[model samples]
Target: MNFYDFKFVFYLAISWCNLLEVDGITVAEQLKDVLMEGYDSSIRPVNNERDILIINISMNTMSVLTLDPAEETINFSSEFILQWKDEFLFWNKSDYNITWLKLKESFLWTPDTTVSTSIDTNYLIDASERYVSVKHDGTVRQSIYAVFTNLCDMNVDKFPYDQQTCMIKMGPWSYTTQEVTCIVGRDIAPNDTDFGDFHGNSEWDFEGIVSSVGETEDPDVNFTFSEVHFALTVKRRPQFYVWVLLIPTYIITVVCIFGLFTPTANHGLREERVNLGITTLLSSAVILQIVANAMPKTSELPLLGNFILAEIFVVAIGVLFAVLVLTLHQRAHTREWRPPAWMLWILRMTGSSKFLSRNITKIRHKSSTAERIHYTGEGAYLFKNLDESLQSVREYIQEEDRDYFRELTYVKFFDRLDFLLLFIFQVGNALVTLFLVKQ
Candidate 1:
């Protein structure tokens, strides 16, 4: 074989292989080539440059990952359905021998739809391995699984009882309103029966959705962009906070209140009543910090925060009352020190005398009603002088005996004051709670 004969033989073999049909030459095989003939993916598939191409957008929620209160964002998985008429992608069914075609996403012109309010500020997470559906009538339908974190202007004013409305703000990134119009959410989750397909978040309840189509004016470019907003409202399930924060804090506050005032004396000695108040106050403060840490560092405080503050206030006030109690008990050691008239009256009126310690009750004033009131008052100075003068004549009225009487009188006074303050603390706590919860 000469050199020219060898070249002709190689060319003949290549030409024969091209005609041997590596793939079947059916209409399905040739449809893509004919559709792409002189096709431009960058150009909008419209008859006129100024004609508005209408895109219908809708979504079905697959699952919600979370509604992050601190980040002010929602993470969810969704299936977005987009449909539009592509004037350039159509063909005659008689010639193609097929009513529809599934072409690679790369083979067709698609809208550059972006999430305007997304934290990432990126286009939707379209299916990387998706096919664009084309009917003989030029209708294009595309669906993709999109998972994203969208910015939601969360108003947690009511906190656990709050419902937040967040939107998926979608729009053509480069197309003006004159070139495109979007219709959104009008037919969302059409097959969703009783939300059977929706996998909900454990911390939130998925409320219904609303949608609107509007134009967004960009002053910098002096043009209006078409926008579609699908707003979804979610309500918080407050049971978690109620259990972890509210119930525990309330129980702790009540326990601290009782620990502060309820007389549990050991052998006539005051126990660690002051320590109880201060310690519980610090614990409540720590709990408050926990609640704060769980939330974003916002200036406005939540209702739960206010409720914890009120608990701390009550505990602090209890501490103050505890200090007052110790002061009264200390001052009683002075022979001239006497409990005030109101303190004496409280003990008699509220029947809080029964709450006195076993040792205090044993030595408490006991006699006729008239003499009981008079003696419990710690008497005038002349009376003390009379008792001292009588001490010399009656050795039975010893100095230690007089001291015991004075100690008993003031200890009873301090106990009565504690009871009164406990009542005040409960009332104040209730009022503060009502106000915070109502807001």
Candidate 2:
């Protein structure tokens, strides 16, 4: 009774265990056994080795991070959508009661698309956290999120108003064009929507995107490979530069010009204007250094640099002319030194005689107004030694010398110069600013 009953119960338990319902793990195990029987990732997923595989790829920019003009590089966040067919991974949906399988990218064959313009020589599009979606029809889809740092073609000639273009090429790293081809899906541009949470470029605007597919040759190996190129155009936002750098420099120049014309009463225009000019030059130099720090080293000067340089030039000129005007003021040391007839004519011709005299009537008022007279203190002494017959003529000439000094004093000359120089420099500043803007 003991031996027969124990054997029958053991056989009954084994039959019940084998009759239990199969689960998800069992279905997956059966699929793996059938699909990965002789799978090899090194070779293309095709029945014949000579067949070329076409990989459809599209990249959508999520956001732009930065663009370094000095370094000639740009960094952007993007996603790569890649689709290809893997014949070996195909399975009947009815057999496993499943339409698709989400597997690790490492477990399946993936395209080795290289970023040709990447700044890092060992750049990699990491997909460690991603998966390969294999459908029932043998089609595989994968999405790789990567941050690309690549070379950019920038035109800083306009600087704050400038636009930049960058090209990103993706292709097979090792395979030739004959083995594989990469096509940029022009119709696959829908992934670039700004979904309300997208953070655009911090210092620039995302202008537009253009894509194309072509072939390239490896110089070292002489192997032709297919490539998909993505060209991105971005425009710079000038608000930061306009408010911070440009406006300050412009204001300094205008103030320096107005300061150059301050009355030469207290400290004199020479000292006051020179000090102001030097201060402005130093300030401009500091701002220039800031601008230069942000720009790449180039031979041709950019528009902003040119504007700052012009400001420095105009201030230097004002300082120089101020010294010259103050020197003319010193000629009236005794209040007896006279100006030349030409100087009197110029002050009157420019309608500045009244302004220079500090009144309505005291400027360039000659005694006789007959082409004026020219006589220094030495000339008067020499005339006294002339013959008696010419005594009256010499005496008359001596009297006229006083008229020349009284009519146009060196003080008037200095004032005339101040009026003229102020007008000239103001016009010069306007012209320089306008030219830089238009250029």
Best by TM-score: 1
Report the lDDT tens digits of candidate 2 across residue range 142-255.
877777788987679887788887888888888888888988866223234642123346688777667899888879878899989988778888889889988888889888
Worst 10 residues of 2 by lDDT: 357-366
Q: Per-residue lDDT tens digits of candidate 1, residues 94-164?
A: 76568889888877889988778876522364445678889988999987666778988778767768888
Per-model CA lDDT versus the true structure: 0.74, 0.74
Q: Which regions of candidate 1 fall more than 4 Å away from where they truly are? A: 1-23, 94-97, 121-128, 187-196, 266-271, 349-393, 396-399
Q: Give the TM-score of candidate 1.
A: 0.79
Q: Could you tell me the TM-score of candidate 2?
A: 0.77
Candidate 2 clashing pairs, residues 3+ apart or interchain? none
| lDDT at residue 311 of model 1 (Cα atoms) | 89
Q: Please estimate how well model 2 matches the true structure, expressed as its whole-model Cα lDDT.
A: 0.74
Error of 1 at 354 (Å): 19
Alpha carbon lDDT at 100, candidate 1: 81
